[model samples]
Target: MEEEYTLDDPTLLLQAASDFGHHPGVHSDASAKAFLHRFPLPVIINGCKNREVAKGFFMVRGWGKQKGSFSEVGCCVQTEDNRGFGFGEYFLEESRSSREMVMEETGKEFGFWEDLWWGDQPLGTQYPRLFRVVVDKNISISSVLGPSRPFSWNLNFRRNLSDSEIEDLEGLMRSLDDLYLSPSVPDARLWPLSSSGLFSVKSFFLALSQSSGSPQNFPSKFVWNSQVPFKVKSFVWLVAHKKVNTNDMLQVRRPYKALSPDICILCMKHGESADHLFLHCSLTIGLWHRLFQLAKMDWVPPRSIYDMMSIKFKGFDNSKRGIVLWQVANIALIRVVWWERNARIFEDKARNSEFLWDSIVFLASLWAFCSKAFKGIPLNVIQLDWIAVCTP
Candidate 1:
């Protein structure tokens, strides 16, 4: 017998009233004005005063044994809505003995945990959830008692009850399927904001989601690409390094100079392309090569930082190597890259391959050794660029 029941009465209270020439009802005009007492009353009493549901319930004056308990006067109260549903009357009129029988028989046959973190997640539809900014409240439950005893539970839709259980011990076969409920919104808070990285410039950048396309470049959590978040911190540093990379040279005679025309100030041969100056160009490649040699590693200049981390090393375990390299390189590369950027911008000249190589080597060695010794991770020069930790 699979069934669910609701106690048909919506009010959950019984109502009764009598005619109004009321006798022992509340009627007082005086308030709690501190001063003299035992004075003649200014106002008189009548039938019943209008009342709303509120908390100033009563006042107790006579101390215990000051008089007798029975002498403690209680002014009678009445409601115009006739909702004086007395608790004493309810039990005598509708004694729910039926529930006792059901509970005694159903015993421990039906049970489940309260799953607070139930909801439809927006990403990776099959997975539970990923971006849980708040605390997660979820529960795990075992199979229900089946085909042996009849038991049932229901969530009142109006009451907004969730994490409920239902069981049908008689002629039941299938296990109750796990489900997630929709979440509710809380009021917009005027609460004090904590300085827990809340007012970051990263957040300021994130606010400009639309409107400006070219100048606006920050991550958005709402319409997020899975690849974006992992690259965010590095990307932010990379974006800031632009002034460091180009320095005062941003006022180029033209934004669109043919690669064959304007010569690269570094290589002294081919023209400068945003792509070429940062990559493929001989001057930068030489710097990278010398840096790699100092670190006693073979030279392999990736087209971009994105490709840099993508290149795999063969000497170590695959998964561990990538993660270790990334962890180490993430900060070290950003710092060094910004340093290179500053040298070009402020110094008005790029360092020679040897000098650049020495800097890279120093950074790489210091970070790599620290990561291995203290952090138990490895980082390489290439892995330090603006790249993601995960592909998906």
Candidate 2:
């Protein structure tokens, strides 16, 4: 990608979009003579030949990238400088709407109108800028007359949340099914000694993760499956990817260290990367097969957890199937894996595929019941599921 421009260029900055036309349609001609009508020759090029002339014009005060526009806000002006006086304005007036203008002015907090030199009613003038407002999901903008384009930012909560709003944020977390787990979660104190990640409830949700908008990052592809809701995607990414403190830094809480990091809690032979716990561990693989049979889905053993989630299974759509069965599968898998890990470390419980099998099945049934009962898919579903996951 071209680097984002940090410094400004004088010539390009000086070029206004308002002036490049001759008698009338001349600016449309693209010939050197057309440009000379609006700007002095010296302003463009010292040795003004036709070939060099157009090139020179691009560097002039009102000619280049900032091609003049008559637009007040809505209609688009051609990059070509100088259209008829009313053309771009007519388009703007026709296209612009007051509501859009208001949204841009208020919602995004932008625009420059520090000084107004002069104005006339007939000329009909105002500072042009992108007016954006976040209304539900729709945003509106009014590009005012001239070269500039209007832009708006949709703030999640205006600059800062009010006390009432802050209450709502806290209430939202408490009332809704939990969406995150982190080492620092306040609820960590609630965990029994048997739980492996005995961090606060907040810490469990704050794992380092790729930022939400990264197109290539895994979080981007995390489909809003029936298993997972869109409202909670951000929460999931934080825990799973540990991109808290906004994707640049890792782990919001301290990194989770198993009592012993080297040995797999399930097999006690393998190491614990995501892959080992989710797939290569023999106990986990068996849990996968049994769950697949229970869900009545095809079973292709994943060599790794990433491989498992990465596969394109047939017929996965949310609205239609709510294959909540699929989401249940993921929930069940993660829970079982963590359960097995805790069992080994805290309970000194050894690996038992049979135990893993029974644990996931029972847990899936419990969550499926909760989901159906209007519990609103628990957020700390992992931790909540942990209650039912025994070390044995």
Best by lDDT: 2
lDDT of each: 0.31, 0.38
lDDT for each residue of candidate 2 in 1-392, tens digit (9 for 90 to 100): 22222224223422322243333565532322233224322122122233334434444422333222221221112222322111122211222221112112221111222111122111112312111111222221112222132222232333465565556545433432322222221110111211431222233223222334332334234334435444444444443543323111322243563233556656657655566666667777767666566444687675645455556553223332234445555656666676567666779867567766666655655555455432454444533443232111
lDDT, candidate 1, 69-137, per-residue tens = 111011222334322211111111122211111011222211122211112211112122221211222
Q: Report the error of model 1 at residue 286, Å.
A: 2.0
How many Å off is the CA of 270 in candidate 1?
4.0
Q: Model 2: residues >4 Å from true position, as ranges? A: 1-261, 295-304, 315-322, 372-392
Clashing pairs in 1: 117-137, 148-169, 149-169, 244-341
Error of 1 at 49 (Å): 25
Off by over 4 Å in 1: 1-264, 271-274, 290-303, 313-338, 369-392
